[model samples]
Target: MLIVSTIGVFIAQGVQWRNHLQRIESRGKLIVAVRESEGIFWANGQEFIGFEKDLIAELERELDMPIQVFAVRDLDDLYGALAAGAVDMALSGTSFGTHDVIASRPYAMTRIGLVHPKTRNIADNPDLESVRTGLLDPLGHQDATKLIDNPPQASAVYDAGRISAELFTLVEMQDLDQVLVDERDFQLQQSVFPDLQFSALDLPARPISVLFNPREDGTLLTQIDEALELFDGSGLLGQMTDRYFGDALEFDYVDNLTFEKHLTARLPTYLSKFKFYADLQGLDWRLLAAQAYQESHLRANARSPTGVRGLMMITLDTAKEMGITDRLDPDQSIKAGARYITTLKNRVPADIPEPDRTWFALASYNVGAGHVEDARKITEKLGDDPDRWIDVRKHLPKLALKDYYPWTRYGYARGAEPVVYVANIRRFYNRIKKEYPQLDEAAEPERLEQLPDIDVPVFPGL
Candidate 1:
């Protein structure tokens, strides 16, 4: 009788275990553990966005369930949550190893690389013995030690917590000769330190996967693996990867930090005026402020050697055309600059979309509308998408070439200036919007433009 009862209990437990997916479906939500990181999983203030977040969203859609994401502080915490059955799964750049949790097939692969300042001649096979490598604490001491067979005499080892912090240490403090970082991260950091150079290290590519509780039956794992395969087959995975990681390669760290600093130290004085004029001109106040910062660093008395003056850095003719008497006055200058940008935006083809249209206008604001049109023409002639900012930005530099400019209607132009100008404004505007989210709720301005697709421009005679 005791043996019969034991067998019956075992059968009941097996039947109950089979209801895991059904229970999740009935609950209408899946609890997930996620760590916040750029290109992985992070919250963008208003919404959760990142590569892992998108992947989870796909799973949610496939299962017809919503996800309730809980933030995990680190990888250890993510694994703990999965082991404890507190979360259905954890989405991160987790590698496969331990049998404690089942890992889905790798959704992405990334390799590590070494970055060094251009001031050093490490390009032609660097001397591992002399190079001082900086490694993030999360990278593990074993990996750091393995980076160089023979350790350097002087090395700075510290963990800044986040990738951006480590990058800031490398660029601003100049404490380390080299940094071991992920390839994607190195690409993004290159935008900040234009002089920095990178070389791929001889390390195996790391596989990124999602972790599920080992206690669950293989059914859940099977479903997730099948769904991931479907996503891959449909090319959705590729599209999502491109959308998040593709254009983030170029971010100017110094300029971004400077803009953030100015927002607090300088922008308060002109905040009301910027909003007032921006509202009148049907523009985002942050965008107008960003343009002003790009032009004059928000200096009311700023004057260029070429006679452009005031907060907006408007030329004498531009001021007159916009019907402004005193270009030095902050209010008048801002209002005039808004009007001019609106006019420039109007001249762009109507088919161009919102944010791209705004970028084209900013480019025109720097180099003039004629040169931008010439670049667009060249973009189309080259059989690229002329409406897209990414394609046009590539052709913009070709205008400086003798062969290319001679054919353009506008002749030769400092085509590179506008590209940098627009990029700077876009970064500034995004930072401002993030720092001051309340500004949007108080004033219903249009959504800010996306980051530009152009490389960081090296302006002439800066």
Candidate 2:
């Protein structure tokens, strides 16, 4: 009788799981709970984006349904919702629970470490209480007691609502001394604070995965695992990783030092000019400044052998088109360059989405818009999506090859330069945005020639 009762219990649990999954399918939306942070989830214009957000989209596609994101304030809130089935799953930082409750596959990882301002030098494996210490989380994870000197006291942690990057800012301002950090969080923060130092603690990397309720049934879990397997194998995971964390992975001391020197010594002189012209064109001034730095190392007197001149390195013909009588005058040069980028962006198809759309425009700014269109033709011929930057960029380099360019209208261009040019500008722009958080991008501006959204330009000399 006892054995029969246990079997009946198993049947009841299976029925409950079926009902849960059916309700989700009938509703037509899978609700996901997330803790919104820099790399996890955040807003991009009116639409939202991040690694988790992208994964949710992938999951939506895999399951053939829509996914809704419900943001919880902190881990405790996140866990409570998951336990009560208020959310179908969670996509956030590492979640610790009993084996049956956790998803089997890890989608991401984060290393635990100690981070502090450069002003303080910490020795290896030093005691936590010895310094002005804080934590990434207020309510500690499951293994907190085993990982550190003393478990994180709720009072010792920073405000739970503030994201890790914001705490890093407090560290930079000398208001906070030390904090426990997740390397993934600091990887994004490093763009903003090149001077902060990091030392990894002797702890295993935490694997981030979606958490579901503990149950006898594995139907939902099985679907999640299958979707993750396909996403991982298809290389979409790597592409998403690159989009979020690639820029910061390759660290160069000299490049950072040069950026630091110019940011402090030269940027103040031309900051207002960059902002003014950028506002008039509805572009980010930090992005424009990054372009100028790329062109001429922030020198007003900068000139190239190709006869491009001034801060933006505007070509004579291009300068003339924008009414720039003096390319050497920094203000005139910035305005003219801003106008040209908008012009190139206007040539891009309106159906494409930004970041990709802006990247396409920057590519045009490097090589002419005609050559980019030629590359798009090549992309289409190769059975790839022409609208995507990833697909178009791969084909763009083909234009330089003798075999490929002969078939194209704008034959034989340095297709490789635009790829490198756009990458450098993005790196510089990320750093500059973090370095100067005080600079707010201006609101909607008067469009140029009724052109739509655009990016900052790149000089043709690239």
Candidate 3:
């Protein structure tokens, strides 16, 4: 009688577990708890994008269900929601060994570090007595705090707020001498607070993972594990990591801030001309403005030592071919530049696809179409996708090498210039889109023309 009762209990548990899996599939949406932080799960105002968000997208595809993300105020809220059965899973660069929640296999590792204003002179190994160090609250970071051997004499461990927000506040207010943060979060904050600089602390790497409610059956966790394994095995995970983190790791924060300042102060005077010509050529006005800023910082009278002049920095020969009588006139210069970019875009192969197609056109605008084709051929020869800009840019610099250049149609060209040129324009365009979100819909050409031109100093190598 006792053995029969034990078997009956096991059978009932099995049926309940199966029901949970069926319920999830029948619902057709996975409820995920997310916290907004850089490199984790933040929105760009228009769309949500981040490393964890991308991972969730892959999981959703694998499960054949859409993910409904619920925003939590902080990490504590994220875990609480999971515990309360409000969300099926949670992700916020969570590390292993977190209590209560079952953590998935680590997808990435990050280092804990210190960030301070670039203007400040904090020592590489400061004595704890000399400066105040800010740390995120004592709740979920006991492990991280234990690693800080020499904590500051005056420490402020925040109790309520996002970790990134707390660090930013401490630095911006100059309330703390330094603050501890993950390297990935520090890089994300650099875009907003460009003056902040980061230094890695001597600490063990934190493994980033997804967390699920402890009470849930193993089915959901199993699916996530299988999806992650496939993503890693197929090299998609590495590609995604490179796509998001590569630029941020090496970005020039100061230069980016300076360009942003120019977008507000200098771009208004010529925004109309760029929009006018961009509309005529069926291009995004911000892209044209980005290109103009890259070439001449939007100065109509700008001239390069290479004999390229005006807003677009067109050569005298090219200007004549484009039917522009006055290269220095902002209107003529912008119109000719748009036409030139459009011509280059049309010249690229039709099957290249967007973004890549646009990138190829930008490269051709910097160098020539022939040189770009050479780089594409080199990309294909090296077993990379030629249609992808990321792959092709790697081969662009090889044009300078004797072994590679001699074999290409374009005998010799400064191939690396176009790579930098395209990257700068893309960065500038993104900044403009973020800073002036209304520019596309609300900016009036006449109003922009009415704004007085702000005299911006010409920077070298622009």
Candidate 4:
């Protein structure tokens, strides 16, 4: 009996020793499982990006440790990896489905809604009611031949096969009616293809957060929690949240009132110049104006403390590269800015979609194209969607860190600035779009005229 008791004590001591070692090792590094999507968190190649990026960074700082993010195919894959000890935890803001994974306190929330092609003429839910009644055919399987011919007038269709890539092709080809898709996807689509339009309906928000193994308890989990709380306290979490989801981030109009007043006065000066440049580039003048407003508040004299100068805030290096002698000259600045942006857009991989392409270009514009390229390669490595602005933007700042950038082809960069720049641009774009509803209509003719004329220069090859 004494021998058996001695053996039991030995087993207990071994377990205690293992636990102590785990706590010690946990202090040095934290492994977080993420996904391969764009917005919530995903791998872009070798880089992990999205809101989770900022979260992880903040957590690392809080715990005084390094974070190693692992990319999975999707949220399900992440959960499985966590269960199997393939990953320490997941930071994908994964939604709580009926599946039983251990989830921490809810970190963020967003309503999920349907998205569709902009050309679909879906102005609102009421428009959908008419389509349901029969203004258009309810799209269905191609082999099923029998579409709802003259069926109830409806605004949209919900069939699975009808709303995927095939449906988008059909819309491009003018084949079927509108497709019902996720609203976030719609926003992403609209950003990439500014020509696409969509509306939203109130739906239950999918509250999301990090998930962990139920049975696992180690130093890493506690450190992550501490980081989360620290970020939340410092307002960085809120900042990151707003950086991704406009609604999630809070802003004060009072602080913006003076800037708005100044913008109201300064915006008009760029209208004609914006139109001229937009026409030249085959872009919407309003979008250009929106971009300008976002960049420099339409101020010709605007300058960032970072040595970015002039009305359009063109960097001296960028100005010199573009062969502009006058950085403050509005016409030259606007022209050079437009050309540079257009060039950046053309440089992005063709497969990367809108908003993301545009966002990447904008990020490259803020940082350098090379840095943006590095971030993209990292994104691909991390398993996040490199083609997504929502995903890539999160990874952009990681370029600033040597450990992360060493793995990329483009080397290192100052990444955090792009995140702020892109988010600020998005907010200004949304604000301008809301204020000037007719701007989109006015900008259409200019975009259409320039489309065929614009020569998008290919990267590496060009």
- Provide backbone clash counts, one per model: 0, 0, 0, 41
The residue-by-residue lDDT of candidate 4 on 307-392, one tens digit each, is: 87666688887798788988878999998888888988999999976556777888888888888888877787888767766667
Candidate 4 Cα outliers beyond 4 Å, as residue runs: 1-9, 12-28, 40-49, 118-189, 193-203, 218-223, 247-462
Give the CA lDDT, 0 to 100, for residue 189 in model 1.
38
Model 1, 37-139: lDDT tens digits are 5545654545555678778888988977787776553455556556666667777453342346677787877666667766663435545455566653232
TM-score of each model, paired residue for residue:
0.59, 0.73, 0.79, 0.44
- Higher-TM-score candidate among 2 and 3? 3
Cα shift from native, residue 70, model 2 (Å): 2.8
lDDT of 3 by residue, 1-462 (tens): 999999899998884434445556666667776666656665554466678777878888887888777655456666666676656777766444347778777787877767788777466545545666666434345556555534545454555555675667677788777776677676655666677888776678877778877776777888888888888776677666755665565477668877878887889998777878899999988889989999998789998888899999998877988899888999999999999999999999999777678889999999989999999999899988788787898899999999899999887888899988887887777567656554223321111112222211011111
Q: In model 2, which range of ten residues has the least summed lDDT?
A: 453-462
Which number leads on TM-score? Answer: 3
Instruction: Please state every model's RMSD to the true fold in angstroms.
Output: 11.2, 10.7, 11.1, 18.4
lDDT of each: 0.70, 0.73, 0.73, 0.58
By how many angstroms RMSD does model 1 differ from the true structure? 11.2
- Give the runs in model 1 whose Cα sits over 4 Å from its true position: 1-32, 37-45, 48-68, 83-89, 93-269, 279-284, 303-307, 315-323, 342-357, 368-383, 401-413, 429-462
TM-score of 3: 0.79
